[model samples]
Target: MSSSTQHLLVATAALGAVAWLVGVAVITIGIARARNAGDPDATVARARRMRTVTLALTVPGAILVAAAGGWYVLGRDLSIDPNWWIGTALATWLVTTFGSTFGRARQLSLAADRAGEHGTDDEDAQWRIRRVDLIARGELLLLVVAVVVVVLQPTAPL
Candidate 1:
């Protein structure tokens, strides 16, 4: 690929990753706040919206990651060992974060839906919402570690 094309691909990947991360963070915060309002209908609405948004973000994220020139870490200019560790940390963080949040959000959506239909607060849904927060926070901690790994450029001792 031409130098300009490579630069463009990298820039696009950076833009896409930033958008995805920020979008997820904002949406997760919104969902966390909505869950505490004690309104089943609103909570259900938020949960359903979250599911749609999550999938939307994920599809683009996957495409962007793929288009990142076949993993820039493996590029000839970079040292494979150090870059590989950072890349793995980042990849793991993204996958686990999304998996836990989506799983919890789905459960919350279902429970909240039932509660909305019945016109009563659902303990199950509320519990699930709390779990979502817990999971998000946990993943965020992992994200911090990933960030540090990237910044530190950790590599296995030879």
Candidate 2:
């Protein structure tokens, strides 16, 4: 790719990454706030939209990022330090990807709890949803760690 093309790809990837982060943070916070207010229906609604967010933002962002990485590495010789950071970020991404699976399960559980009569008043359901939120929190942490690894590009000291 030309220099300008590479720069454009990098810029686009950065934008997508930021957009994905913002969406995740907003959705996660919205779900947590609804759960805290004892509003099961609102919690379920927020959790349900997570699939849309993941499909629209997270998945595309990940693909664009990987494409940018592949393009950047096309004719370059990367040293251990660069590879180390990429490896670290990829490791976090792998964990985040797996964690998102459980996160989806939690969302389903929350929706199931509110299936018919609005399980807001059911302490058991509320507790279960809260536990589900814990998974969301962990997934969010993994994403943040991946971003940090990529941004900071930490490497071992000689």
Q: What's the TM for model 2?
A: 0.73
What is candidate 1's lDDT per residue for 1-158, written digit by digit as tens? 46776677768766655555654575578677776786766766676776666567734654564567355544536664545865665575457545664465466566567667664356776566566666666655554465456446556454
TM-score of each: 0.67, 0.73
lDDT of 2 at 85: 77
lDDT of each: 0.60, 0.64
How well is each residue in 1-158 modelled by candidate 2, as lDDT tens digits?
57787787668767766765665676578678887776767766656676566666766665666667555555344554546877766566566655663255445455555643555556565656566567657767877887787777667345
The runs of at least 3 residues in candidate 2 whose Cα sits more than 4 Å from the true structure, single-residue gaps closed, are: 79-82, 101-132, 155-158
TM-score of candidate 1 against the unseen true structure = 0.67
